[model samples]
Target: MRTSFIKKKKNASTDVALQITSMADIFMILLVFLLKNYATSVTNIAPTAHLSLPEVNKSKGVIKETLKVEIANDLVMIDQKPALALHAFQFDPSEDGPGGVSPTVARVLNEQRKLRPEPNMDSSLLVMADQQTPYSTIKRVVASAASAGFVDLQLVVVQGE
Candidate 1:
């Protein structure tokens, strides 16, 4: 059986209108509700390959722009660029920072500070280290960055399970 709504008329066609006013209203309400409850501030930066951050429930703002330093077990990367490769715990003395610090990282930092002199950005350097990375290595990297004028450094970590 066919519905009469599909019938074609030579003169005025049958007036078959869909009553979507309520659906439109519902959709509008839903859009408004979702927009009203949307979070514009809190941002979550996901960890990349060869990097795993510790999960912790903490209220921290997202970094819009900053110099990133990633310290993995086998390599150290600055701003996603591999700065130095590590073999075991002992890094190449000529390639890394100074005493008890990352030499190559320190060199790279120094070069970056010399090349791009962003006084404000120099402070906000974020370090994303692996979970298995030792605390001492983290401290050394922090110290290296500090020596390179990066005082406001943040250690990024995962938020939850």
Candidate 2:
């Protein structure tokens, strides 16, 4: 036998409310984490004035922190200080020591080496040369750097698009 029962009354409020407090908390945490770890891995130093750096189609390897040797058409600077002057993209014969090494450049480099935390460690140098700089001038700078015990040399160039 089936029996009929009285129906229960329904609540007047039918809409459900969404609580976004937990979602807001998660969004804030993610924002702070991303901002804290943001980084830009690029060289901070700008190109010297009036210096046009060579452009390369493709560049390889990461840039390391090293002493800078900026070679322009008329001057050679070590760590932005004038080390020597270039006449016609060449050093004077009197300024050149044995094997085309520059005494001034070598002296400055040696002093920089001594100032380093570990003087005995292998030294690396960065060469930022103008596009108009001659090969001979670059060669002399390399020789001087070698005489000062800088073996690892890196050339700085602009990336071509």
Candidate 3:
């Protein structure tokens, strides 16, 4: 009996079939994580030094029911109420009268404090002024608040654009 030898044939093609389900799952997980983190990390913007601020030794943080004062040209709003209506003044260090901030801020703060005086009141005065508002105005507001027995003063500003 004679035995015949046979040759083994090699497979011609070799290509990988990609499974996209795992890749899609990973992308979805990353997207969800990023979205969740972004939702939790929201923050407000604050202004820079292009705007001037007064020098105060004890600048403190803000608390609830803060007395917000807004100083704009020809307008002075106290706690979102129109407190004073006067012409806007320039930043003049040599001015004899009250500087940038309205002179009545102190009195207003004092009155508010008197009306709602509680032990260890942490309420603060929040000053929001325009960028163009002069340093004198800021100084005046700060001075008024300080004079009104508001040791805690917070300067509100917009964050970087």
Candidate 4:
């Protein structure tokens, strides 16, 4: 009887082992997928020496997709690319088109508008101008942007404590 019981136990086949290697492979693939798709939410704001932004007590946070225009002492940049150059912080009258709009600025802004997801809905620009920049130059830039279908404008300034 004892020999029969041992044979029955041997035939039961109770030596099953869990397959962990496949599970581990699945977890590694998931980790890699997550890492590949991860995107940072932080926005970067860089300050340059050529532009001196005015100080304000309160200001709103900048949107990541907003078009940025920087006016320095000697140059005007769109999205950090030089769009126009100024002589002694002044623009030439010939640079202005009909209705006092800058043709260079208008062309660039139009190109940017087409790249937007909703161009009409995002008709806004963030302008950072030097403190010493003349108001006339700023106005011309604004006019050019407006002509390119960007009507909502926000001036970027240094946030004060």
Winning model by lDDT: 2
Task: Count the clashes in each prediction.
Answer: 7, 0, 7, 0
Clashing pairs in 2: none
Error of 4 at 116 (Å): 1.6
Who is ahead in lDDT, 1 or 2?
2
Q: Write the residue-wise lDDT of candidate 3 on 20-108 in tens digits.
A: 99999999999999999877652222222123433445445443446667777656667656665545634333333453444566667
What do the candidate models score in CA lDDT, each in turn? 0.72, 0.84, 0.60, 0.81
The digit string of per-residue lDDT tens for model 1 on 61-124 reads 5565567788887888887688878654336666444556666677798877766656545566
Q: Which 10 consecutive positions of candidate 1 have the poorest summed lDDT?
A: 40-49
Candidate 4 lDDT, 1-161, residue by residue in tens = 44654444446777889999999999999988877766443244454438778988877766455888888888888877888888877887779698889898899989988988897788888887888888888888989999999888778777798
Of 2 and 4, the candidate ahead on lDDT is 2
What is the C-alpha lDDT profile of model 2 across 1-161, one tens digit per residue?
65657666777897878989999999999988877756443434555545888999778856787788899878888887888888767897877798889999999999988987788895899888999888888999999999999989989888887
The TM-score values for the models, in the order shown, are 0.62, 0.72, 0.50, 0.67
Q: Which candidate achieves the best TM-score against the true structure?
A: 2
Clashing pairs in 1: 95-104, 96-102, 96-103, 96-104, 97-102, 97-103, 97-104
Higher-lDDT candidate among 3 and 4? 4
lDDT of 2 at 159: 82
